[model samples]
Target: MTQSIFDKFQYYANLREDVARLDTNPFNVVVEQVLSETEAIVNGRRTILAGTNNYLGLTFDPRCIAAGRKALEEEGTGTTGSRMANGTYAGHLALERELADFFGLPSSIVFSTGYIANLGILSTIPGPSDVVLLDADSHASIYDGCRLGSAEVIRFRHNDPGDLDKRLKRLGTKAESALIVVEGIYSMIGDQAPLQEIVEVKRRHGAYLLVDEAHSLGVLGEHGRGLVEQAGVQEDVDFIVGTFSKSLGAIGGFCVSKWKELENVRYAMRPYIFTASSSPSIIASTRVALHILREQGAELRKRLWDNAHRLYLGLRELDFKLGPESSPVVAITLGESKEQALEIWHDLLDKGVYVNLVMPPASPGAGCLLRCSLSSAHSAVQIDAIIDAFRSLRNNILES
Candidate 1:
């Protein structure tokens, strides 16, 4: 019998069935209402939101809402066209310029979403003659971008600059032109990259580097420019890619660089050219959020880190196996038992705490992960509630 193309997903279909049998689905969590940045209504219960990556908690900022409302009234609801066509609204151009200025870069290109920003730049920048060296634990979009491009793709050990150096050395002469890709803060475990060391290795090998600051943008650096600024390697790095969704609390992505050539890449990028640009309201709100971040980001960053440290220490006190360090993204390592992971995840939800339940392939190691992303807007009480929820699951986690 001829095999159906859908046969490939049979295993996932079985997994879904098993989850349904448990009477809970962590994957399709629906928020009935967002009461605040840190609280939401889920499954008809008031739950503390610990998964949404609203790092700076600007999602409901009055200024951002006002900006969006004004744009919605003046510019209509949608752009309805790609930027290369008719979607380059005045707000879009202004946002791009502001982003470029924020990064102190010569050029910038905005994308409809963070995923496509990676796709557009990664797929277009590396030619057939070049090589793409990336971290083994890179986000799916990063891997997909490399796959879409014509360049040969290679993986180095995660967060190991020494491994990257050795790999680049093996390339010999080609190392000079190879494109190295890594993230400022890894999304899964929330550990930061050793960017200063990575920069040294890149310089020694004469290679270019791209740091995806998706999670780290508002969480690091005195100026909140991300790991690049924190590491003080701005001059050494070639490209900086980031998303506005997390810190800026809007839906968009951007790539900024000192190189003037990125302007030319914009025209050649199919994802950027073909996809409809962000709506006027999103752009307007994003611009206002960016402005807010610039003006009042330090306080927000302090609050975010304080909350992260609090939760991290609280979980640690309970003897929970967590990610390596204190970060806004705190992941509890659960042994290889999807059932136990699901049970604990369901329990957390029952206790009015909602986090991300990560299964294998998506998770880094040979285990499941209960990932919690904290935000600046999360108050002390909310952070403690998140901790208490996990503390209540001690027996389940200990068993695993």
Candidate 2:
């Protein structure tokens, strides 16, 4: 029998079969309505939203909504073209300038997404001879960026500065040509990188460092500049990549750097050049969000961290195994089997709470995890409800 192109999808079919057997599909939950940044209607019930990446709870900010609405009325919907053509608008240029100013970087390049920011910069900066040392537990976009680049790729131990130093030393004179990539806060585990140590290592080897603050911006630092500023190593980082989706409450990505060569990336980077520019509404809303991130970010951060600590302590009291600490992302170890994790996840949803269900390969350490992200908008009542809900479901989850 001749094989069809769709034959390769057997793996997906098998996974679906397992899901059907469990009578619980974590990936198939539907959101019927979004009541606020922290509440939603799901499965015909009002559900507390903790699965989303709405860190600052700016999704429902009146200023952002007003900006977007104004942009829609004045600037129309989309640009209808790429930045290289008719897509480049005054608003885009203005937003880029605001971002550059916010980071105190000499140059900034805006992309269609945080993912594309990595892809564009990674593929364009290093040529065929250069090398990239990436953390083994990096995000998918970071890995994809390395694959797209022409450089030789090497994986190092996650958050281990000594291992990175050794890898660079092994490269001899080529160490200076290497790009050491790390994230401000790893997405899956909700843990942070050892930035100060990594910075020292990079300085010792005379190598450049790129920090992805995708999950850290507006969630860290004094005024929400991310881990770079939090660690007092902002001056040491070469390229800083971040997404507006997480904290800025919009859809876009940007790379900021002191090196003036960054602006030239738009010419050679395929992802930046080929894709249509962000919509005017997005640009407008993002601009407002960025302002909020700067002006009133500290208050929001305090509230978010307070909520995080409350939940972290609450879960610990229940004897649940948790991740590193009280981070914006709190992941509970749900055991090692996919079935066990899925069953618990379905139970949580049935209890009127929603969270992310992580499994092996995609999740670090190949463990099943129930991940929740804390938002500034989460109420004290909601936090208590989440904790109580988890406590009540303990027996059911363990099947005890």
Using lDDT as the measure, which candidate wins?
Answer: 1
Cα lDDT of model 2 by residue, 234-300, tens digit: 8899999999898988899999998998877778999888999999999999999999988999999
Winning candidate number (TM-score): 1
Model 1: per-residue Cα lDDT over 1-400, one tens digit each: 9999999999899889879966568988889999998898998999999999999999999999999999999999999999999999988999989999999999999999999999999999999999999999999989998888899999999999999999999999999999999999999999999999999999999999999999999889999999999999999989999998999999889999989999999999998998999999999999999999899999999999999999999999999888889999999999999988999999999999999999999999999999999999999999998988888899899888
Measured by TM-score, how close is model 2 to the native structure?
A: 0.97
Q: After the best TM-score superposition of candidate 2, give how far the Cα of residue 163 lies from its true spot, in angstroms.
A: 1.0
Segments in model 2 whose C-alpha atoms lie over 4 Å from true places:
21-24, 396-400
Worst 10 residues of 1 by lDDT: 17-26
lDDT of 2: 0.89
**How does each model score on lDDT?**
0.94, 0.89
Question: For each candidate, C-alpha RMSD in Å?
Answer: 0.8, 1.4
